[model samples]
Target: MPQRLIASVLLGHYLSAFTTLGIPLYLPRILADLAPDAPGWSIGVLFILPTLCTALAAPLWGHLADRHGCRLSLLRAHAGLCAGFLLAGFSPNLTVFVLALMIQGTFGGAMAASNAYLATQLKDGNLSRALNWTQYSARLAMISGPILLGLLTASGMGLELYRVLAWLPLLAFVLILPLPADAPRRQARTSDGDGDEWPDQLPNDLPRLLAVQFLFSFAMVVTFPYFVPYGEALGVGNDALIGLLYSLPHLVYLVALPWAQRQAANLLLPGLGLLALTNALQFWSDQPDLLFTLRLLSGAGMLLGFVGLHRCLSQRSRNGSAGRLFGWYDSSGKWAGAAAGVTAGLVSQSCGIASPFLVAGLVAFAALVLARPLLIAPREITA
Candidate 1:
């Protein structure tokens, strides 16, 4: 693979990360300004609408990529992201803003498109390494994007934040224009004598792998929304420290990339085991120091699951089907993330802020119990 290709993907992913995470970061303010009369339930629904749209629409877009070409598909995602932000920035009312975000979710699957494009260009270890690099870009953005936005706000550039954000994806779109194109590898016909259509390389046990994806994703992301609050309740006072602790898993991934590339999907099982133990243990940890240790351990578990799943999919990807395979793979995660956030919110309200972690731990344990043969068996290839 060309270094320029990977660099191009990483830079685009990092730039888009702002829009991905930043919009939600400031959504409360945006909602208050646009819809002061909006109900509380509606606010939560609006916050999650984009994710739900993405979950439902990813496969359609992926199939389009499989039929046409990945390069065009990637450009379509960037263009969609650019258009969505532009609409959000210039919207005259709340309805337009809502429509704008829905469009964004339905179209702007840049991460899935990027991974699919990379998969078309790579195989085996190279594929896994490229996937890890894209992850690194997002992790790096998670730590820095907030600080960068904060600095801009401090400088009084916070007015019409969406307007400022629109430019980032536009820039990313232009950056991707020069990368190599991946033409589709279509089969001439199926056994039924169909015309030229891309056939899927699906094995019988695909649902099993997807189940593991959903459970693992749910276990990990279910903790995200309430992590800071959980830390505060545990007597960790510094906001900066809390931020760092919340980011430990991402930070750990950065430091462990070299090792992670070597291990790949092999980490999934042990990772779930460690995550379950640490999350359950956190419930009993009253001291800040112990919470700190548990958070770090949880990060390691997350790293294992992330690498393991990506590599497994990489190995499963067959010619012409990377887009569809990775897209559906991501939809499982998208659905899990949305569900996890809602579950965490409800659990924290009814139980305690710490209860979500316990819930997440149990989900991981259950997944581990059910995931053995589906996850650990040798790759089920398509001819």
Candidate 2:
């Protein structure tokens, strides 16, 4: 595990997340300019599209990385992202902008491929720590991108907004070019009796792990898309400030990850319990003071849940079925995210934005209830 390799993966993580954050920050602005009369329904649909695309595309991209070289797959995805940003920034109309975003999703799982590269290069003992750090880099990117864009958008640079946002992906593309490629792993997995395809006999534990990821991710999705609006209704109107609120829990989690791994040995159950509590707080909180307080609590809980989930996945991968297990984990998570996005969006449209959070909290509580059984069994390994 050379430092440069981790740096490279972390850098990629940052860029991918930065680009993803930029889309949402500018989304309201985009709608205002392009579809001023559009209702929540339209905005909600727009919100769901990218996640839907990513959900559909991630597995394919992961499979490609498994069969092809991770390095090539990564380079190709970055190139696609560069092109997608340019298209997004330069689109002549709304249709073109969204189509470009759809294309972006087509290349969306570069992060997964990048992670695979990290796992392959990292020594066993260091892998979870490295992945946790990688998660932090991404959290940092998400935090920075939205704040930067909000500042730029508020400055009224007008159409220059697109150009400014374009710089994130452009810089990322430049940074990624020099990173090392994953050496071809055992001559690459191929089809038809080559024993090269992704592993066939995934351990039963893999599905259980994926199920947990899906449930947790669903809880996240239920509230994430609607939280900004909910906060606004409670009189917290600053976009950058709201972004800060949204991100702080991740910051807490980022700070806790190294220590949790070192001390807890098994962070999964407690993490899920905290997460469920956070969502429960959000579900009932609406008063301005109460909302902010719940948000702070939720953030802390999220830190535990997400970081613990990543640690578990990293540990699971060490048993020799890294590709299939991690891919299933990501796929499950993305599908959960997509389902949450759409469900929450539709619920918000019909029942008001707060409804989604209320429902989301209940779902998180249920996930917490069931998580203990899923993780209680002894760890298992794949051949």
Candidate 3:
């Protein structure tokens, strides 16, 4: 890929990730502003509603991208996201805020669109590397966004920060406008003496892959919404520290990517096992240092397992249905995340905040079992 295209994709990923992950950093404050008397579980509800919408919208966007064009899909998604944030910033009550989130989810197919677009541009080994780089951009945003929000919150500017941040995506939309247009690739598959291959359907392994995605999303979401409050309960109350804890895994994930990509096949089982172990260990630690270390280890596991899984999926792309394929993949995860949010809230309400981590660990173990049959020695991709 040309450097200019790479830059554009990175910028898009950064803004998207920032806008999405950044909100959760100040979610408590946002809720307090919108509904001063709202119960704690409302946080989970707020996150759940938008994700459910995204899940429903994803496949439609994918199908549209394949039928129409990815450039148009990209423009529509970014514009919708910009409007959603603006509406959210101006919301006067929890009801209006929830509606705004629904709008955001309805329009937010940029990640899937972006992935499909890139798949058309790069092939084989180059494709996997580009995907990893895109993920790296998102992980980088996951780190910087919270830290920036933490600083703003500590400086007494948190109240108006979300409104200010709403404009960032509009800038991203402008950045996207100059990129080359992408048309659908719908060429029929040709036989090469081996037999026939259908272009319209997903790979045979996709069902199992979707199941893995669901389990992965379920595990992550169960612990995510409660991380900040969990840290507060453990006596780390600084906004910056809380943000660091939230981002620690991704930070370590950035460091582990190259190794993970290289050792993907060898690392899958161990990585998932480590993830389960780390999540389970959370139950035994209240110390900030110990928790941070655990999160860092979790990042390594994520890089190994998810990077490998995504590479396998990308390699299976056929026909012109990359958009539709990835859309379904993304949708599965979001749906799982939505369910996990509600379940996590219920569990936390009846049990304790720390209990979700254990549940998440158990779920990760199940994912490990499902992943075993799918793990193949990845062929080295050369640029």
Candidate 4:
């Protein structure tokens, strides 16, 4: 792959993740400004609507990329993000802001399109490395984007911060424009001579892989929303310290990316096992230091499992189907995260915050058992 293409893809991935992940950091402020008396239920709706819309739109965008071209698909997503941010930043009412976010989701398939574009540019071995790099970039953004936005808001930017940040995706759109155009891969015709379309049936292994993706997502998110509260309960009430605890895993994940990529094939079981152990152990400790250590290990475990799964998926996908396949994979993880969030909220409310970790651990363990064959079996492209 050309260095320029790699740079463009990584930058685009970073910007997309930065904008999306940073929203949560400023969500309360945004909500307060838009609807001072907004109901608690509206909070969930605002967050979930874009996610659900993205999940629904991803595969369609992938198919469009497969039929049209990756560059155009990516440009469209970026354009939409730019418009969405502008609309969100300037909206006089909550309804308009939310509708803009929904519009963003409708065109928000940048990550999927980037993956597909990279798939076309790199062969299998290099593809794994590229995917890991892209993931690392996104993770880095997720860690830093919120901090950056928060700092700006603290310095008196307030909601104006959104208008400032809106320029990023627009810049990304310009950056991608100079890259070489990506042509859609020609598809083989059906027996009855039907026109080109996405494959009617996915590989048998795909469902199992998606299941693992869901479990990994569920396990991680089950404990995500409660981290601040969990830390406060342990007597670490400082916001900075709590934020550090939450970010420790991602920091470790960035550090562990290269090793995870190198050991991708053999990582699934061990990684899942480590995640299970860490999550389960969370139930036994409220000490800040121990929890930090557990989170660090959990981060390492998650990096291994996640990179391993993507490597496997990339290797297994047929040439023309990469976009659609990754789209499904991305959608599966998003939906799983959404489900975990809701379920964890309920479980935490009823049984205490610690209970979600226990449940997440069990789910990870079950996924490990169920995914054993697929993980250990020889890699082959399936129809």
Candidate 5:
């Protein structure tokens, strides 16, 4: 639990996001230049395609760590990200670019790798706090990565720009390379009986926890597709305001971390319930103030729910399967987000842009019901 190691992990994670999110953020312009004749719908498919690859390939990362150990696994992810970005940077055609994106998705998962590494080194509440900090790192990256990257590339998705950006992940790899090996920290925990427990020694079944991850992730992310449009629908004309609405949930994680962490167990149920309510309330108000308030509340719910669910899964590290467990856990969320995006697109086409919020609300309510037992304070917390 060295502060230096924890800070390094967070910084590495922040850099990794620049490479992982570039495709989704810049695909439209990239496609416009490379494949102008391509159909509009293909853009959406390609946007989600990399995510699907990540979801499918996630469990493999776990197995890698189980065999090679977490430090190597994390370094591998950073190197993979650099390679993927380099490939995309130099891609000569749409085929190559798409392949490069797939490579990035398939190989890059520093966030999950970081989790596995941290889970190996810490336990109980300390682990939870570290995971929460990781979440902050991730949110900041997601919110600012594209804007900064866009400025660097001039939004061009060019060879030189991408190649330059590749250094970020390489930088991450270098940051992690200096950290202590996993065996020592893991051994220390094992001596305390943490390493003696079973990988399945969690509060509930692994599959059940995975289920909550999927549902909760789905509900929380379903708003992504239409938040700007929903804001516009509410008569918010300022581009900045629309952007703020979209970012409020992420900002909440930064602003309310201490309170949210303290009340996470209590917030878990309400947070899921809030996602449901906020989405439903989206239809009830066209007032910008009310919508902004709803978005703020939505952000609070997300923080609570995310921290709680992560703690629930972090307990599985007792048996030293942190890599695999977190890998699969990462997959579950990716799959859910992809599903939510696809579903949102289809539903929005027929039902209206705001329709997805209602569906998300219903999904959130169902997720709340499913995740209730895990949120309750119990003997399983320290396992």
Candidate 6:
């Protein structure tokens, strides 16, 4: 596998996360000027809606890629995302801002398509490691975007940061021009054809895996958007400190992800336990330091869980439904994210920030309990 292709895929991931996150972090600032009616929690709700749109759109893109080629679908998705960011950067009205976010999100399945592309291009044993490295790019972008936006805020010229963020997607459009699409390895094959029976190729474990994805993703996305507010509630209200608190998990995740990738299915329970502990800390702690440490542990859990999940699914790619499986995974994950975001935001608004964390932590703990059956079941391998 050429490093350039991996680099290109990572570039897309980086830009997508960078721009998507800038909107949320800067929402507090943007709303301060335009939509004073929008409370911070409302802004959080607004931020998650786009991901809801992405969740809705993932399957369409995935299905299209299954019939067409992932390369073409990816190119079109990127082109649309660039346009979406441009609209978001210039939106003068809250309604328009929401619309732009949806557009950007609708095209968000490009990441799934890109994942399919990489799975097709890389050999099986190397797939999990490659996915981790690709994921690191997005994680890096998530960490960088907020820190830079925080600096821009301190300098008092942060309103223009959206424009800066928009440039990344625009540059991505330009950069994607030269990459070759993954050649179709199963073009003439059909699930109905004896030569390529699709159902026979489908992973029997999909239903259980999808359930696992929903649980883990729901816990993750829901907990994530609330971290900043959680810190503020704990009396660490500084923007930079809030950003640092949010960044802590990714910092820890980067350290754990690569190792988990190498360990594969063997890492599942430890990963689930990490998630359980993260929630446990939230259930008990009120101090900033203690909560931050817990958040880091939660991130470690996510790293382990995701590496295991993706590794497990990537194994199914050779079954001839890789694109469809991944599309379902992305869609399921995003929907869970969307639900978590809205529920967590509303819960925080109605009760308190800490309420959502404690509640969602409990949900995550339950998810870990349910994950055991699937991880232990022996069935099929596909990647």
Question: Where is model 1 poorest over a 10-residue stretch in terms of lDDT?
Answer: 188-197
**Per-residue lDDT of 37-57 in model 6, one digit per residue for the tens?**
775667766667777888888
Best prediction by lDDT: 1
Model 4 — which ten-residue stretch has the worst lDDT?
188-197
Off by over 4 Å in 6: 32-42, 153-160, 183-201, 232-242, 286-289, 346-353, 376-383
Q: Which stretches of candidate 5 lie over 4 Å from their true place?
A: 153-159, 184-196, 199-204, 264-266, 376-383
Q: Can you write out model 2's per-residue Cα lDDT over 74-189, one digit (the tens) per residue?
A: 67667777677678777777788788778777775556656666765664457777777766876777667776777777877543465555566566667667776654434432
Q: Candidate 6 at residue 17, lDDT? A: 67
User: Residue 270 in candidate 2 has what lDDT?
Assistant: 66
Candidate 4 lDDT by residue in tens digits, 96-211: 88888898777776777777778766767777778878778878998989878877878766556667777888888888888887556464223213533333224567878888
Rate residue 69 of model 5 by lDDT. 79
Q: CA lDDT, every prediction?
A: 0.80, 0.67, 0.76, 0.78, 0.79, 0.71
Which tens-of-lDDT digit does each residue in 333-367 have in candidate 1? 89999999899999999999898888888999987
Model 5 C-alpha lDDT versus the unseen true structure: 0.79
For model 4 the local lDDT of residue 353 reads 70
- Model 2: weakest 10-residue lDDT segment is 188-197
* lDDT for position 330 in model 2: 66
TM-score, cand. 1? 0.92
lDDT of 3: 0.76
* Candidate 1 CA-lDDT value: 0.80
* Estimated TM-score for each candidate: 0.92, 0.83, 0.85, 0.92, 0.91, 0.86
Q: Rank the candidates by lDDT, best first.
A: 1, 5, 4, 3, 6, 2
lDDT for 6 (candidate 5): 94
Off by over 4 Å in 4: 187-202, 378-383
